[model samples]
Target: MANNPCIIIADDHPLFRSALCGTLQRELNEPQLIEAADFNSLQTAVEAHKTANLILLDLHMPGAEGFSALVFLTAHYAHIPVMVVSAMEEPDIIRRAMDHGACGFLPKSASIEDMTAALTAALAGNLWLPAGIDDTPAANEAELNIAESLARLTPQQFRVAAMVNQGLLNKQIAYELNVTEATIKAHMTEIFRKLGVHSRTQAVLAMAQLAINPNSTLEAFRSQALPLQ
Candidate 1:
């Protein structure tokens, strides 16, 4: 596989991963294939193999609560193309994955031919979706806005926000992130300002809203008492 592209198959199911690997081996020209069963390992693999050409990500894998892993990857590793391969094929899910910067979406049930085609297109810098699936109905303006705001966050601030969502206290987050409590507080303040929130609770709530229903409109989000600030 020397000098060939490196592709990651990030899925928790061992059987599915094996099948996908077999298909890739058959379809591709002996590309370097890396396998990860969870989001943490996926991140580590990506970091170690900076030349990776593509990532086949699963939406519900361990350590990837909802679209958070996708969001984190797109935010931090924007250069590597990601193609989501998930069992969930709902249009809304597909649309959201695309919105979060996935280059393509392949349902787990797709045939080997379709998988090959999708992966080829994504590697060539083209977006791919299943046939008959409308690519319109893009993520609502509110969702887009939120994504843009989140993208503005520094990497450390982004990590802090995720910890906040996990209900970690400021001190706990500080210890885990290996920063002083005051440094954590300063990061939280900036995070709140960037996210348009006044308090930690409001900041957490805002992130929760996006996580829960990223496709919802501003009005719908407000209805849940998640008004900006």
Candidate 2:
């Protein structure tokens, strides 16, 4: 109910974003809205609008690998609250989003009333969960600990680690980030140190711990670990 609260809608879907914008404008008092279609752009928007009141992030965006973007934002932009807005509303994913630092989880299918309530709670600095979901943030677990470590990474280092988790080589990461390979190597060293893992494979495993589908990351890592025939 804060007057003219600035909100960033960080989802890739244009129609849905527009509709959500309309809903907020109608329900709230002159809410200022910003749109970001991808994770990278969300970061840019956050940087440009550091005073933003809230960010409605998509579960999957171009530069977001699982809940990594959530972790990065909560870590780097600790002041602004992030309420994840996504179509994937599985209970576990919603809980994990909160555990990883999301203020709320608003399913894309949420009714206008539900969206308004969730936004109100989040803006008031409270946690919000969808109907039938437990309001509590997830309990302490191995992934939470790993999230703590990943939270320590600088923005650039987080990007490097995310790229590494996707199996990108140092040179490839450097090219994508428009930096030199040696600079990337230095980043890798820091990322490993921060994550408490020395090798890229170990870093990958560490990062995988934060994936939305817990089983899939472990399974994929296991398949990679199997001996070649």
Best by lDDT: 2
Looking at candidate 2, the ten consecutive residues that score lowest on lDDT are: 220-229
Off by over 4 Å in 1: 1-3, 61-65, 212-229
Expressed as tens digits, the lDDT of each residue in 18-137 for candidate 1 is 999988888888888999997657867888987789999998767444676777778888999999998889888898889889998999999888997898898888899998776675
Maximum-TM-score candidate:
2
TM-score, cand. 1 = 0.81
Evaluate candidate 2 by giving its C-alpha RMSD to the native, one decimal. 2.5
| Runs in model 2 lying further than 4 Å from the true structure | 136-140, 225-229
> Per-prediction TM-score, please?
0.81, 0.90
Every candidate's lDDT: 0.79, 0.84
Clashes of 1: 0
